[model samples]
Target: LTCERYPVRRLPFSVVSEEDLASFERIVPGRVVTDPEELEASNVDWLRTMRGCSKVLLKPRTTEEVSCILRYCHGRNLAVNPQGGNTGLVGGSVPVFDEVILSTALMNQVISFHSVSGTLVCQAGCVLEELSRYVEERGFVVPLDLGAKGSCHIGGNLATNAGGLRLLRYGSLRGTVLGLEAVLADGTVLNCLTSLRKDNTGYDLKQLFIGSEGTLGVITAVSILCPPKPGAVNVAFLGCPGFAEVLQTFSACKGMLGEILSAFEFMDAECMRLVQHHLLLACPVQESPFYVLVETSGSRAEHDAEKLGGFLDQALGSGLVTDGTLATDQRKVKMLWALRERITEALSRDGHVYKYDVSLPLDRLYDLVTDLRARLRPPAKHVVGYGHLGDGNLHLNVTAEAFSAPLLGDLEPYVYEWTAGQRGSVSAEHGVGFRKRGALGYSKPPEALQLMQQLKTLLDPKGILNPYKTLPVQA
Candidate 1:
């Protein structure tokens, strides 16, 4: 099968023969899947944007099985695509050609959890939400959280170095993920799974695989440092009359409640319209040009509530906020958070999505969306912007009834060039999967790109791991 939107010729990798299938069956037994019906879902990505046509899928249960599968595949010079939850927004987790699909679905197991240090050691396939519940019961919380937590695997999160709502408080996975175990292309297991908080060991080998998008190695297990569950949590959804007010309110928030602030997210009025129209979710606050979601987590309920109230009062009195609604109850908090978290789902229901995740200087974060809206309104259904305002990331999305080549042409180099002009990142939290591979140069210099290629060559000399993804084509 050929990818029409992103055309690519098949690479010169060895095709899977009967002997390969038999060997895979011997390794995974009943877990080798070749039926067309069974392989359909794993062939596509979460955004439904990319599809692959792999003939085999292997479900490995343990690290040993993963090593054996890779070792055999490497010996035969077969391309292997490592898959986790398949919840990636980019086309990273799926195969672009007839590569062997190595899935971690059966590797879901929590090995250990230290109650005092709040370190969680688990197999790669453990679902993020499941791990969250497991740690919450033990008075701790997973350091990261996103809309796809219900289905996203911790392995995929590490593969992308995912940063979600709690990132403002807990920071990125690169810091929280203290150690990990990964299997290289030659089936050598790099066991670095340690739970230590401090280790000045010569080289942090785990960092190489954290955001490599499964190109360097297949992550088998992870040891992450979880933070203690806060005693109190509060969410406030506020409406701003303009983007200036939204920025002012954020400044006020940091000045007043920075210590306990957990998240600061903002969305345009268009995003609110889509969520309300498609998801049937009611907005918690009054109608306004912009909206912001503020969350606070702290040790004492009364103290956190008082601080949030003071921040809100100052924001409203200073004309930084026009209307707002606060939630302390669990049910209400979820409802409020849904308005921001479910924007991706709502956009999907609208039509084809041209999704772009970038990091810009806070002052110019929303300008790209405004420029695009003016440039492509007739052909574009909606051009909206929203993301983790605390971290200066923008999720600029455009929708239409269907994908159009001309529309994509209008978005490409323009968006990348604008982001580059502002000295911003083109991929942001989303790793450089197939879709963004060619755009890597817009974010990194020639020297950096050359070093990345050297590293990819060093790790997988045969280029058998997740080929046609991440790195850009060389000149």
Candidate 2:
């Protein structure tokens, strides 16, 4: 049924026979899940747009167990889907067909942490929020923060190279992650998990798997550099009269706040309405065309507060911000953040959401959403835009009563072409999973795609690891 909605011919790979299940049981005894009821959740993605019929789910606790399982699967010529958290917006986390689901759920462990250096080495399956708590207790904070931090695994985050709220201050996972250990297609363990920040010995092999989306290998362990937890943190929720004013406010924010600025996120009025209507969230500021959430983190509370207050005064004085509310306490900070972070959940509740994550020039970030709202008049229930403005990532979401092929037809090539025209990324934070594999050409050239295919082939000769993901199928 899923295949009917998103058609793909199943590749020739061995199906799971009784002997195969028996071998998997020996590899990860008592962890091989085959029951359909239990597999239901694992087979579906977080967005619920993609579904798979994977018969076997393998949960391994250690890299050795994962290596052994991949080794066995490689020999059997069976397709293996390496999954983590299963919170991927793309269909990459879920098996497209009957591929054996190799999950890192049971590999949750903190391998090591250096308090002085603030380097954290942890198992791939450790939840992001728990890791954040663990690091915060030691006076450090994880470089990234996502809406699904409570459930999304560190491995999954690395696999997708997730750029979240704190990316503005901390940079991407590719920069924060010092090293990692991954299990290759043939079960060879590539152990580059070093805590050292500067290592230019040779080819940075770990970078290959950071955003490869599991098509290259399964990331087992990671060593990341966490920044020291800020002594003072503040959140400002402001309403902007228009998109231009929002841009002006961000410019002023960066200028005034300087290094203390941690994040700059924006959402249209439509997104705020959806959040209020569906999630029962209250608007902290007066209603306006656009809203911006600015965050500050610094070592000195008084100095940080002064800088933030100055930035706010400048924004309000310049007519960049219509109305605003600043929060110094943790409760208010969290409340302000919830309005931006929960936009995805609110949009989902409204109707079937067609989500697109793109990176455009800052000035043209919100243009696509406005264009779509005008284009899809009758079918589209709502077209909203929201995302990290500092990083130039736009989350354009369109909702309809339900999924319709005609509606999708109106969005596709048009959206991709518009992104390509601006020389922007079609998939900014989210990797090119099964759903966006075909659109890879929009972002990458043919030669790049060819080289990507070559890398996939060299790393996974049999194409047994996460087939139908990341790279586009060559015609």
Candidate 3:
């Protein structure tokens, strides 16, 4: 039924017969999971939009184990889905139908950490937050931070090229991840996991798998450059009279807070209302048309505080911020952050949620949410907008009592068309999983998509790796 709902047809891949399970067991003994109950979570995605009937789930702990499983699957022309944390918004993390699920749950291990260089080498299955804590304890910090950090794995984050809260400061993982270890589709081990910050080789081959969404290879381990942990951090929750004022405030932040500004995020009142209604989390600032969360991280507490204090004072004095609150301590900072980070949870509690993560010019970012609010009229419970304002990414969400076809009909190509009109990306951080493959052209040109297809064929000639996903369906 789930397969019928989508457009993709089953590829000419082998079904997991008992013989295949036996072969997989030999590669990772005691780890071949076939229990339907155990396979349930892996089959469903984070947003519950897609489901797959994967009959077999393989847990491989080492590079050799992964290489063996992939080699066998590739040789037999069996479809495979590589899963990590299963917290992706797009429908890419699960099998579309009966593809085998290759999980990285057992591959978690810290390979090495160099304190002086702030470099960390770790297995792909290592949880992002755990690595954050590990590095923080060693006087460094993971350059990336996201809401699902507690559960999302480092490999998944890199697989999706996740751009989270810290991108405004440390930049995307493409810049921070020095090297990686990946297994090619046909079982060749490609190890480029070097801890160097600067290396100009013939070609940066590891970059291919960074955001390929597992269609090219399975990322086994990564070597990344970590910045030293900031000694001082500050959070400010502010309310703005309108979107224009929000823009002015962000301009002020980039000018005054420049180097220390770690993140600049914005949300509409609809988002705040849902956070209060479902999660019962009270809004920290007085009600306003728009809200912004500005975070600053620096080396010296006194210096950062003085800089933040002046920034806030100027924002208020210029009426850039209608009202605001600042928190310097850790607990209060997290509580305020919960206002932004817990939005996905609140949206979930509302009901079935249709999420759109897009990149647009800051001036035009909120326009789509506004456009949909007018067009959808009713039935759509909420048309909420919020996201990393600093990076020009917006998380547009629409919730209803349940999934509705008419509502979807009104949203689909219209949203994609609007994004194309602005020359914006249909997906910013979330990779083009199954559901979004059709819209990949809105962001990437035909030539770019062609090149991507050529690369996919070259790296995964069998078309057995993550089949029916990532690549655009028609082209």
Candidate 4:
């Protein structure tokens, strides 16, 4: 039998009996879902590629309910997959077998907000954009923003340690996320939700669950530090002559714009073409070998505009950028961002996508893309490269007419080997889901991986939480 189809062996602990179901129904009336048809939507991932056969989907409204459900599941040896907005790129959000899914969808409540400290505390299932809207009205913005903001949950963001468009200016969740409350594998509630900026107390335990991908626990609540919304913003889309010019333009902009520069995103000609052709979005810049989207946010409109214009002037004067378009209005800014944010969606529409999110030295970023393109050769229709250039993270995506074993084989060791050679990370923003589990050794040493395994064994002796996911099997 397949690993997933293996029959469950009854344990000594209590199982979900008819009476237990009755108790669950009474506790959270009509919230627990058992219908197969209704559970189908949550059984799959955002990619529509990975599917799971979850028997039950629990929507717990309060942390107490979550605690109770997990306590029962722990004793019953029932594997649980904690789902957020279900927008994860990897199959981490969905179940691999017949595990029960515990979704935080009903726990979408804002607990508290401190305007003076710019700290916002909300339930784990809260949609990212909803929190952004709530804080934006209070003259503050969430430290992080991404294309999936409309669908991804704050809890998912914390789980993945997502680095998005705003990372260039506002920094990562590691710095912005103040505290987290997560339920352990054995139903122990870990409440470390402190809003304090500086805490020199013992081991920073919250960091463990930040990027654990729900293997260690289910995050119940999140306390994040928000940044004050910029009073004015300016966006400029520039088409560079080549990768070399793109780097030069970035340096020039960094020097000229300094702290005001919020984002420095890069895209190649093929990426822009895919976005234009697939999404029907008009390209803002003239044809070029490469394109860059530069953004500046500051307290004054005139200052932000001047900073962008000054940087552009220097870039054009130095031949770093060939053509450009600047946007001052909010409508135009959104239009420009759509070109960058929608590239992933456009690529998805093309064909089967093999996605790789890697972090290399900023200087060697273009080399990896160029090398991968040469290695893929003819069968791979297109190998496009783009991502948060400022953070030295590259989203190297390959699109093919069909998924082929040969294509995957050629890219696997070569890509990971190249990344490791440069003292870079194999998985940058995306966590080591099933797709990248085998490549964990490329980024992490044997000693570190051993420690990780030790911790995993200590936390989950039964291996019930997200089994066969993040960690790789021993040789």
- How would you encode candidate 1's per-residue C-alpha lDDT over 68-142 as one tens digit per residue? 999998899999999989989889999998999999889999999999999999999999999999999999999
| Deviation (Å) of 269 in candidate 3 | 0.6
The CA lDDT at 434 in model 1 is: 87
lDDT tens digits by residue: candidate 4, 179-217:
999988887899999999999799998999899988888
Q: List the candidate 2 regions with Cα displacement exceeding 4 Å.
A: none
Query: Candidate 3: which pairs clash?
Result: none
Error of 3 at 228 (Å): 0.3
lDDT by residue (1-475, candidate 2, tens digit) is 2366766788899889999999998989999999999999999998888889999999999999999999999999999998888889978999998999999899999999999999999999999999999999999999999999989999999999999999999999889999999999999999999989899999998999999999999999999999999999998999999999988898898888999999999999999999999999999999999999999999998888888888888888888898899999999999999999999999889878898999999999988888988888657899999999999999999999889889999999999999999999999998889888989999999999999999999999999999888889668
Model 2, CA-based lDDT:
0.93
Evaluate model 1: give its lDDT: 0.93
Models 1 onward score TM values of: 0.99, 0.99, 0.98, 0.95
- lDDT: the better of candidates 1 and 3: 1
Which is better, 3 or 4, measured by TM-score?
3
Q: How many residue pairs clash in model 2?
A: 0
Winner on lDDT (3 vs 4)? 3
> Which residue segments of model 3 deviate by more than 4 Å?
none
- Candidate 1 local Cα displacement, residue 118, angstroms: 0.5
In order, candidate lDDTs are 0.93, 0.93, 0.92, 0.86
